[model samples]
Target: MARVGRYDSRTIDKIYTHVTKKMDDNILDLLDNL
Candidate 1:
């Protein structure tokens, strides 16, 4: 496998996806708690 380079779109996309999922999960939990 190739090593990831800086500013790679794929890496950025992966980070964005992980963060979005975390945010979505948190929001759902908050709504459930309310």
Candidate 2:
């Protein structure tokens, strides 16, 4: 049970990092356009 929880958390962290990075890129693009 503990191992499964750890694995799930790791997966979630990866997804969160990916989403945040994409958002940062989009924000930068908008700023550049302005």
Give the whole-model CA lDDT for all candidates, comma-separated.
Answer: 0.86, 0.86
Q: At residue 3, what lDDT does model 2 achieve?
A: 56
lDDT string, candidate 1, 1-34, tens digits: 1455666777788899999999999999999999
**How many residue pairs clash in each candidate at the backbone level?**
0, 0
Query: Which digits, one per residue and each the tens of the lDDT, describe model 2 over residues 1-34?
Result: 3655656776888888999999999999999999
Q: List the residue pairs that clash in candidate 2.
A: none
Residue 25: error of model 2 in Å?
A: 0.3
